[model samples]
Target chain A: MAEQVLLLDFWPDPSGVRIRVALREKGVEYEYREEDFQNKSPLLLKMNPVHEQTPVLIHKGKPVSESLIIVQYIDEVWPHKSPLLPTDPYEQANARFWADYIDKKVHYFGRSVWETTGEAQESAKKELIHCFRTLKGELGDKTYFGGDRFGLVDVWLIPFYGWFYTLETFAANFSIAEECPKLVTWAQRCMERESVSKSLPDQHKLYDYILEHETGQNQPHL
Target chain B: MAEQVLLLDFWPDPSGVRIRVALREKGVEYEYREEDFQNKSPLLLKMNPVHEQTPVLIHKGKPVSESLIIVQYIDEVWPHKSPLLPTDPYEQANARFWADYIDKKVHYFGRSVWETTGEAQESAKKELIHCFRTLKGELGDKTYFGGDRFGLVDVWLIPFYGWFYTLETFAANFSIAEECPKLVTWAQRCMERESVSKSLPDQHKLYDYILEHETGQNQPHL
Candidate 1:
């Protein structure tokens, strides 16, 4: 089979990182092309016309939008090494459930926390803490989200661990790890994997980038 | 194989309807058990401990939460009749993409429209219209979202059509067919199916229920 070029319209996005991690874990070789939202490449627009958002992966000239969907596509296309999802239908659905849960609840709650102020921020923070605690309880004895193996859910969420720490520092009102020790430990275990560790950016650097942008010192990384 | 007793913890939710539609479409017989959020059943709580929300499907003792996940699970488990998804990997991922897009974007924007007031309401309405227009463009010349057949994405989103006329009546701000004629047509085509027609309740009834609940009536249906 000819090698497919994977064009990723990404910008340090945790969602995009999931696909990158999956590709890296699977050892799938593909060409990468970065996209700037302010000046979006025509290819990106052509690929995902509806959302016109980032993290669009162009595989064999066909564009796959949505991070989780792209990750699943990559998994299917390259199923030889380091399978991202479970083989069993039930287990696969369970993995997808957790992944979707994180995407909807945790991801949205995190954004709500960052995008608001005062009462709204307080409310979002409360929701975030609740989400983290629930996830911690679920992660109780498992080394990874998908039991002993690092599977789809783990890859989808591990990138957010760095961002969570950034939020804890910048917000200065909450500590995700302190609130959910098991989640913190689980995150640490995920980061221990070379694929995850190598793919993730520095937490403090991300914090500085966010702070600079908010303070008008840095431009939007679109 | 033994007849699987599907224990569904559902309420009058559009998300739950996704699974209900899938079950009906596949001609799968399953038991339905409605859940009360105010006083959740132990089974519901145990099934989905993290979210503690409805639309939980307990099939052969294993519980599946998340509406889309349950829909896919049902499709995988029972593939003899009308298939909910495409067999081709790319096509399956594309179907999943649109189904998820509707769940995230359309559903979120619709909730914003419902929960806001004044300027916020107007903004949400505009957003909803934009989403509808985009969807309409995507569905241009296609009978269903799955291109010739009524597949996963169609089943996942068609139930919301029941709310469109009601939203137009109460909100008195937007017109579904007027704004997105193609989408309206596609929705109409979907509703024409016996499976879809039989599974959903009347639009006016749902509207009245919403109005009653909003005004503190809290009736049984509401």
Candidate 2:
């Protein structure tokens, strides 16, 4: 029997982009169904009843929600090509640790930088820079987050490169490149990959979308 | 060379309890160091510089932080005994999804019920109940969360059983057994295991500690 793979996704969501990169890395053929956050499709609502969110991977009609989980699933199911996680148990745990760290710390603080102003935004900017610097410290002289291999942590974080321009120009006025040069270089390196380049939108395009969405000039997209 | 394992933990912290349970399941013996929250030990800080929180497991002098990540590390390191995660790729993802769900949803709302008052507390209570019911629906008639096997989701969740009495008597005033009988039964079945029973604290003792801690009549523990 042929494999039936479908992905419910949104273009600008870093989470969805992560899944797209993973799918492309695994060379999995999947039907991409775009979700409308204004009125989420019944299929999405049904597939991910728990979250009612996009980036749900439907495999043989079985739904898998959560982007990181989906990517891990993709890696595990299609283990032959473009291995995303380390085979060594300790190394795998380390990769998972950093990926989980990116999930918990980076996104929350990054959003706060652009979404708020005054003391809250200032604190968020500080914390976000601290997070990036910590990530840079972790990266050190390594080619990627998981060392010589472009693996879990890289896949999880590179999509956020799309928001860097907006974060720099629109909100914080702080330069990530100035603060964490190595991480910026790492992002550039990741962008060179076909999977990553295709998955992430142009940073300027994302910036414009953020401006439009914030000013109520454009329809909301999740 | 003998394997040197050390655990920096604080009793009554559900996160730490989760780690203890996983360690017991793996049948690995380790020295347990209780961290004083008021004056965190240098080892704890040095081990987990990012979060600086406990349930940090040190194996061969290297540290693994984050409760769930530590648990996964334990499972991987001690794969020969009491496998915590599923071998099947899809099942592993499913278990991970639910475990992540518990991490995100359960603890936050559970805290809100005990910490807030008035309309906020009422909403938190409602949401916490909704979360429990969702978990119950997931459990259904299964003996354990991972179906027959007491695995990742079960290990991650059973620690919260220690908080049930405190949650029921001092906070929400709702009975989980009444709302989710099957789930409560599942908890009881899990409690029967030595690894779980030993790792989780007595519910009544936890209630007293919470009362004293909230009333500022006792030293704070994390």
Candidate 3:
């Protein structure tokens, strides 16, 4: 039986880009369907009825929602090539812990950086910088988050680098490069891979997209 | 070397209870340390510097934080006994999706039900009911969330049942049993298991503990 894989995603979405990178890393051939939040396609709605959000991976007609879960799924299904998670149970757990930290702290604070202004934005900026520095400490002298291998934690985090332009442009005096240089270098290293370079939209393009959409608090909803 | 296992937790914590249940299900004997949030132990801080929250499982001196991640680690390490997750990649993904949903929706809104009053509490009550109903639909006629085996989804959810008394008592016109009968029945079925029955604190005791802590909008922080 032939393998059928489909991924529903929205352009310039960090979560969606994570799945794209994972798929490209695994060399998995999949049909990409872009979803419109306003008029969501029936396929996406049917596939992910609960969340009805982007980055749902449909493998053999079964849907898997959530970006991290999809990435893990992709890794498990295509285990022969470029293993994402470590084989040791303890190491896998540790990788998952960092990935969870990225999801809970890094992503959450990053949203606040571009979404708000004044004291709220300042606090978020501080928090985001702290998060990056913490990640830098975790990375230490390692080439990748998984240490020499571009693995689970790397896949979970590298996509956020695509939003660096928007975050720096919107949030006052914010420079991730200044705050965490090692993380910047790590991201650059990740970008050298074709899978990452192709999967992430140009950071400038993402900035323009967010600006065009007027996503900040003061701006009117389009 | 003898396997060294230790768990640090707070009594009546839903998250902590989850790890305890998983440990029991795996039949892994380990030392349990109760933590006092007022003056947190140095070990808790050292073990889980990132979150600094309860339910840090230390196995062979390596700490695994986050209840869900710890549960997965236990499952992987003790695969010889009761399986916590399915072997199939798709099934595992599906289980993870629901577990994530419980963490995001069910637990988040359940907090609101006890922590707010008036309009906000009423809104939370309605949302909690809707969440339970959605879960009911997902559960359907399954004997457990994993179907015939109490697996990931069940482990993620049953801990919340310990908070049912507090949620119902605090939120006006809210009754999970009335709103989602099958789900209530499912909780009862889960309670039959020694691992679940022992791990979860008595619902009434949990309610009293929350009351003593005075954790609500109007209550003074003690």
Question: For residues B104-151, could you state the per-residue lDDT of candidate 1 as single tens digits?
Answer: 778777766655677887887888888888777767788888888889
Task: Please tell me how candidate 1 rates in CAPRI terms.
Answer: medium
lDDT of 3 by residue, A1-222 (tens): 247988888878888888988988988888888877768899988988887788888888899999889999999999998899999999999999999999889988988887789999999999999999999999999999999889999998998999898898898788889889999999999999999999999889888877777564543221
User: All models, DockQ values?
Assistant: 0.69, 0.78, 0.91
List model 2 lDDT by residue over B1-222, tens digit each. Answer: 156999999888989998888888888898899988879999998998888888899999899988878888888888989899999988998999999899888888877777778798889878988988999998888888878888999997888777778778855468878877777888899989999999988888888877678545345533
> Candidate 1: which pairs clash?
A37-A222
TM-score of each: 0.86, 0.94, 0.94
Q: Estimate candidate 2's alpha-carbon lDDT, on a 0 to 1 scale.
A: 0.85
Instruction: Tell me how many residue pairs clash in candidate 3.
Output: 0
> Residue A206 deviation, candidate 2, in Å?
1.1
Best by DockQ: 3
lDDT of 3 at A192: 97
Task: List the candidates ranked by lDDT, beginning with the highest.
Answer: 3, 2, 1
Question: What docking tier does model 3 reach?
Answer: high
Better of 1 and 3 by TM-score: 3
lDDT of 3 at A7: 86
Question: How does model 1 score on DockQ?
Answer: 0.69
